[model samples]
Target: MNLIGIFGTSGFAREVGDIALAQGYQPLYIARDQTELDAWSFAGTAILESEVEIYREIGFAIGIGENAIRQKVARRFAGQLKFINLIHPSATFGQGQRQIVEARQGMIVCAGVRFTNNIQVGDFGVFNLNATIGHDVIVDDFVNIAPGAHISGNVHIGPRCWIGTGAAINQGQGDTKLHIGTDTVIGSGSVVVKACESHSVYVGIPAKKIK
Candidate 1:
C-alpha cells in the first residue's frame, strides 16, 4: 500500500520507476512541479509525513549544472521526503562486498567502493571494485562498467554505454554527457578523448571509432 512517486519523467526517473516496481512499491511518476505532486492525493497517512528522518539520512547531488534539478529536488525536500535505496539482490555491499560508505533511496548499485550522495545513477548499472566515480556524475541506464575504471567528477554518461576495464574519460568536466552513446562498446584499456557515438566501438589510445 506504500506508493512511491518518482520525480522526473526521463532517464533516471524512469529507471527508478522500474526498480520501484521490482521492489514491490507502487511507483508513480510525477512532473517537476510541486502542485502536480501534491494533487496526487493519498487515501492514507502519506509516507512523506512519516519519513523525515529517513530523508535526513540521504542526500542529493546533480552532476549537471541545470538549475531545474536543484529546483525539483528542493521542492521534494521542502517538507518531509522519502528517498529509496535499491540494490540488486545479487549485488554485494559492505565488508567483503561494496561497503556502503553512504546510503540513499532509489539507488541500484552493484559491487563497488564507497559512494557519496547527489549522484544520479541509471537503472541496472554495475560498478566493480577499485573503480572510482566522483560527485555530480550522471550515469545513464544499463551502463556496464568493468573493474578498475576511474571516472572523475561532473561526468555524464549516456544510457546503455559499456565502459571497458581501466578505461577513463574526461575527469568529469566541461559541458557534455561525456556523452557515451547508447549500446556503444569501449574496448579494454582504451582512453576516451572525446565523447563517443551511439552503437559504435572505440578502442586504442584516444579511443578512435574503429567500428
Candidate 2:
C-alpha cells in the first residue's frame, strides 16, 4: 500500500488524513518530534522528519494552514517528495464543466466547491468547504479561501492572502479585474469590489482597507 505523509499534527492534519483515506491511501502522520506526534491520536505510523528518508514512494500533503508555515514546510520537502493535491470527491466544476489553466501542487479543495473556467491556482492554496471560485481567476501561492466565500470572475488574489469565511469578491466592470495584493487579509463577510493594496487588511461590505 502506498503511504501518504501529512506534515503537521493539528486538527487540520487529521482532516487531511481523512481526505487521504477517502482517496484510498494509507495516511502516515509526520511530525518534527515525538512530543508533537504523541499529542495527536494518529492511528497510523508516526515518524519524525529525520526518518523520512526511510520511506520511498511516499507522497506528501501539507497539513499546516498558515501560509508562511506551509510555504516553509513545502520548501523543506520540495523536489525530495511528491506533493499531493487533495480534493474532495463532491467538489464540482462550474457550468457542469470547466478547464483549469494551471493548478500547482499541494492544493486542498474541500467539498461542495465549484471552479469555473480558466482558473490558475498556485501551490499550496487552500479552498475550504463550499467555497465558490468563478471564471478567469488567478490564485497565487499559499492563498486561503475560507468556507462559503465567493470569488467572482476575473479576480486576482495574491500570495499568502486570506479570504475570510463567507467573504465575496465582485467581478469588476468591463475589462477591469479586482486585484487583491500580496499578504493581505479580507475580513469575514466582506464584499470586495475594488483593487486592494499589498500587505493590508480590508473589511466591511464594500471592503475598505483598515490597516
Candidate 3:
C-alpha cells in the first residue's frame, strides 16, 4: 500500500488523513521536530523529518491550515518527498467543468468543493469543505479558502491569502476582476464586494479594511 506523509497532527490533520484514506493510501502523520515525534501519541502512525529518507519516496501532503506555514513546510520537504494533490471524492468541479490551470503540487481540495469553469489554482492551496468557487477565478499559491466560503466569478485571490469560513465575495463586473492582494486576510462571514490591498485585513458586511 502507498503511504502518504501528512505534515501535521492537528484536528485538521486528522481530517486530511481521512481524505488520504479515501485516496487508497495509508496516512503517516509527520511531526515538526524530534520533540513532537517523541511525544506524539496520536492514533495514526507518525514520524519525524529525520526519518523521511528511510522511506525512499513517499507521497506527501501538507495537513496544515495556515497559508504561510503550508508554504514553509512544502518548501522544506520539496526535494525530500514527492508532493501529491489530495482531492476528496465528494468534491465537485461543476457539472461539465472546464480546465483548472494548476501550477504546482500539494493542493488539498476537500469535500463538497464546487469549482466553476476556467479556474486557475496555484500550488499548496486548500479549498476547504463546501466552499463554492465561481468562474474565471484565480487562486494563488498557499491560499486557504476556509469552509463554507463563496468566491464569485472573475476573482483573483492573491498568494498566502486566507478567505475565512462562511465568507462571501461577490462577483466583479465587466472589464474588472476582484483583486485580493498578497497576504491579505478576509475575515469570517464578511461579504466582500471591493478589491483588497496587499498585507491587509478586511472584515465587515462590505468587507472594509480593519487593519
lDDT of 1: 0.55
- Sort order, lDDT high to low: 3, 2, 1
Predicted model with the maximum TM-score: 3
User: What's the best-to-worst order under TM-score?
Assistant: 3, 2, 1
Residues 49-114 of candidate 1 have per-residue lDDT tens digits of 233354353332221112234344545565455444554344433242233322323344433444
The regions of model 1 sitting more than 4 angstroms off are 1-112, 175-177
- Write the residue-wise lDDT of candidate 2 on 97-195 in tens digits: 333412468988877888977777888998888999998888999998988999999999999999999999999567777899999999999999899
TM-score per candidate, chains pooled: 0.48, 0.92, 0.94
C-alpha positional error of residue 89 in candidate 2 after TM-score superposition, expressed in Å: 0.5
Cα shift from native, residue 120, model 3 (Å): 0.5
Q: Which of candidates 2 and 3 is the stronger one according to TM-score?
A: 3
RMSD of each: 10.8, 2.0, 1.7
lDDT of the candidates, in the order given: 0.55, 0.85, 0.88
Residue ranges of candidate 2 with Cα displaced over 4 Å: 95-103
With candidate 1 superimposed using the best TM-score fit, by how many Å does residue 32's alpha carbon deviate from the native? 40
1 against 2, candidate with superior lDDT: 2
